[model samples]
Target: MNEEEIPDKNIFMMCEALNCDALTELPASYSIRSCRPDELGIWKMMPFDDADSAKEYEGFMSNYFTTTYSGKEELFFAKTLFVCDRQNKPIATCLDWKAYDEFNTIQWFKVLKKYEGQGIGRALLSIIMQRLEMCDYPVYLHTQPSSFRAIKLYSDFGFSLLSGDNFGIRKNDLDECLPILEKFMPKKYFQKLRIINVPKEFEDMVNKYDTNQF
Candidate 1:
């Protein structure tokens, strides 16, 4: 999707601990599996909300993979996952990535608009968190106000908005984003949102990166 389309403030969230009990099985007829080398195209286009957006983002996604995960293609595919239909076609994808080789961060998480409202995204995220359980604490993710649904889901998994106007190389828009969420999201979901201090270690690790290559 085009950046201008959403125009929402970007925000950061962190899960200091995994909420494994929140994990639930995918609904019948769908399954989760590691991404395959041959399915790179499927992974790239998974983030767009629909087919038209996917087509518009195809080239940009291709280059994003090239520039961001360049030398780590094998590991990237290994850490990435797909939630597929009975036919084994990917309907959603996410990555348990260690950005800058320093800290764990969720990346490229999305379920096709058509398949949403199902339990696919929750199942996929649970599996990713299960995998990260052994890797590190305080997992982080970048998102925006436009993704309030995802923010609610992330909150269910113990992720809270990271407090501050800046996080590493990126500006934190949580202050601005929260008002939007309060206005649009159900009051109950909005009430459950939490804000936590950004971990110093995470901040230091990220600030070391001179550029936001990813």
Candidate 2:
């Protein structure tokens, strides 16, 4: 298929955004906590496992490892942060770390349906944001309108948005991935979930992301 060709139903999104600083915090927690080494894969796969297209989600995970994380799931595990329940069940998760050059992003953020309203996701993301703020580079993340709930959280944390049509978006990216962006999220709906990017003049590249993988 050509670059401008339409993507299939299984396609993912590439919307981009960045945060100049961390602007969120977590509520008090007496039971749930960060993921431990022994409880990695299960938690990492929980959100995808619960999806209608589990196979596609897993395939995307593998592709992501190849393109960004050097195909090393272990390295990703080390970089991941999962909030677990008293019995060690994965409640929420996120990965905030260096992705390319000085760009650090929050990846694979999720919260199980069973634990959505209690602030686990907010707390977990806050912890990751704290880690990112200490880093010297700019913190960024890739999410789409489908991840509707995340828009507010990322916006609150200062992540500015750039869609496929945004001038700040690089020509190469827009040309090669525009179809997928359009398919994953129509331009009109995507605009509503948009965020502002810091250093507005700098060009933006959207990585393969579906922040609401859950």
Candidate 3:
């Protein structure tokens, strides 16, 4: 199934400041590190792991790597990270990617379902944010209404929703997403969401790439 066949809501966000207070220590049994070359397949599938979505993601990831990391496959694998269990099996993954070689953006951040409640996500995000701290300001990311929990986590880390009509080739669903969030998220978490205008620099960088493949 191609992703566009399924209806989805997309939202864009920006973080002007890193909130160190949101950082948490990883549980003792798991370790965080760069992904191994052999784990490229694992890194690609972890976030969108359901069998039904496999076809869609396989296509998406293939295009993503080819268009976004073409000659930088080695760098992609080196920068891609995983939170591994005691057995060194990857349970979660993400990376601090520079979109269009202009500014920082968080990409493919996810934790396996069984590992969800632990501090692994926060810990991994904190480590990535630390790596991105000096690279650029106002980091950006793309997500959806379904990821309300992660959105709350992002807000805790100082990311605010971008209230605008578009982000690159994608339409901003911030307005539509708010009602869904309010209906689905607990009132407190939903209430804490903040909004910000899109900065020209971030807008330009996002549009810099011809992301039709994505």
Candidate 4:
């Protein structure tokens, strides 16, 4: 989908009006919407730029197609929105959707660093949540431990940690997997584990960790 194919110009106008110096510099009111084919170029500006990243993106789309097209689900919502320049060139994005399951999880939310701190991420999240509520399902999402902003946004919207082993970690050794698990697991879950018989060695591993490395 090209810029010409975007049925609504309001998205473009609203983003442009912010006059953001960089994609990450966008204001709070700026929100995300569905992406058009032509807007894919802008969507590509998201942080990941490697083959592994590309493959994961393709996998998400494939899952959407199979589940929605196969009639296993009723609604399949994904996003491909552009953070536009004054001239409507996309500068940032957040794109993903929910499957119509009782456990609806929001996946693949991202934005360019240049557009951070502006309300763009929040806006996109709100749009997706509204859509999810309309479908009558509760929402959930997973984010890297380093994605402090994303976690805060989800929390602000009333999403809390689901109980009992949300981390999906099975390995007993902390050095082998705890760091990665920490990055993605909810904070409340992490706190709960701390009260148990956590080994001093494991606590040390977690204490010195930095989520951005992942």
Candidate 5:
């Protein structure tokens, strides 16, 4: 039967199976309490040694920061957690704490697509907030103005927009116009400020384009 015709029980089983398959693909040592290996083929389908080393390194560093720090950093790390299906595959993801002290920013948020909305996003957000409450840090995040659904979710969870800033250009503002033009313009007319480390042919094409006037 087609997806819409499938019974809720079957649909849930399918979703559970998909999640379990995903978990098996997770990196070694990652933990999940809800999903177990024997309940599905999760362990057999796991990535083995084929997983990307870079991804493993990133995970290691994140775990290290959480373990090494005791104060804010530790709290931030605790806030950042990942949950996957039985296969250890990530269906939804979020960062619990991201802080740039110089910029006075602390962002705790999740980004999930429509198809992955099986209440996973809400559950992940709730976990972050629970950890944050213990740490006593105010939680905040940034999103596009177009994200009405996300805005509503945040509002329902007691977040409010403090201010808004316009990003694009406006014609009437001459002061803004000058800066915009200057920002986009080349310095010394033909001088290249950055270079792409590509093949010789690509570099030659870029140089040729740089010399040609519009």
Candidate 6:
């Protein structure tokens, strides 16, 4: 139920902001910055101490207890970031991914519920967009309509949908991509979206990103 690319009102939307693409300017309020070298280990992920009831959340993220997602390499680790409050506790998070080059994307992007209204999400996203500015490739993300305001944040940052119309994934890999999608997403979500081949946006960025790695 976690890997499906199925588009759901609640499942979060999948979108991307290509490097240097024109963006709709928007003002931000919060102070957003990347984690320092020393804080990387401690600020790797959002605090989810209770792994006992992960299903109770929207995604099965809590299943993994670390600050960062599983299988991340040093490159992914350096790209992780946090939003600290006055006391320096990380209240929001975002991560960079490259396991599948074309699918190089930002994942686990969220602001703790208590910090939702202060524009922390947009600040996090804005800084993320800046990180991708030097890449010839695009920065990818996934979200859903149920998150009303989040959609606006993405659009404002120049993210647009990646569908069969705009994206064209190689046919040979469809067989391999299908299983991964099915494992995480549900069929019902795609039924409503009718967007064929979510993986079509994968742009072979794995090799392209090597030079960009810190």
Cα-based lDDT for every prediction: 0.83, 0.53, 0.82, 0.43, 0.34, 0.49
lDDT (Cα, 0-100) at 150 in candidate 1: 90
Candidate 2's C-alpha lDDT? 0.53
In Å, residue 47's CA in model 3 sits off its true spot by 1.2
Which stretches of model 3 miss by more than 4 angstroms?
A: 1-7, 212-214
lDDT of 4 by residue, 55-126 (tens): 667655555445433552222223445556555555555443433322345665776667677677766655
Q: Judged by lDDT against the true structure, how good is candidate 1? A: 0.83
Each model's TM-score, in the order given? 0.90, 0.62, 0.92, 0.48, 0.38, 0.53
lDDT of 2 by residue, 24-120 (tens): 4554552445556576445537665365655557766655556665645576677677676666566677886565533556777888777777766
Instruction: For candidate 1, give the lDDT of residue 141.
Output: 91
Clashing pairs in 3: none
Model 1, residue 167: distance off in Å is 2.7
- Regions of model 5 farther than 4 Å from truth: 1-79, 102-108, 111-115, 134-137, 164-214
User: Ranking under lDDT, best-scoring first?
Assistant: 1, 3, 2, 6, 4, 5
Between the candidate structures 2 and 6, which one is better when assessed by lDDT?
Answer: 2
Q: What is the lDDT of residue 69 in candidate 6?
A: 40
Clashes of 1: 0
Highest lDDT against the true fold, candidate: 1
130-210 per-residue lDDT for model 1 (tens digits): 887545877889989888889999999999999865666688887777778887689999999999888887777788876
* lDDT tens readout by residue for model 3, 1-214: 2323323788888998898899888899999889887877777788775856766778887777788888887888888889999998999998887777777789888998888988889999888888875548778888888787789999999999998886678888888778877877789998899998888877776676558322
| Worst-scoring 10-residue span by lDDT in model 4 | 8-17
lDDT of 5 by residue, 9-92 (tens): 100000001111112132333332332323222222221223464355555444534443335643443444555656656444
The window of 10 residues in a row where model 6 has the poorest summed lDDT is: 165-174
**Which regions in candidate 1 have their CA more than 4 angstroms from the true location?**
1-6
On lDDT, the stronger of 2 and 5 is: 2
Q: Let me know the TM-score candidate 1 reaches against the reference structure.
A: 0.90
TM-score of 4: 0.48
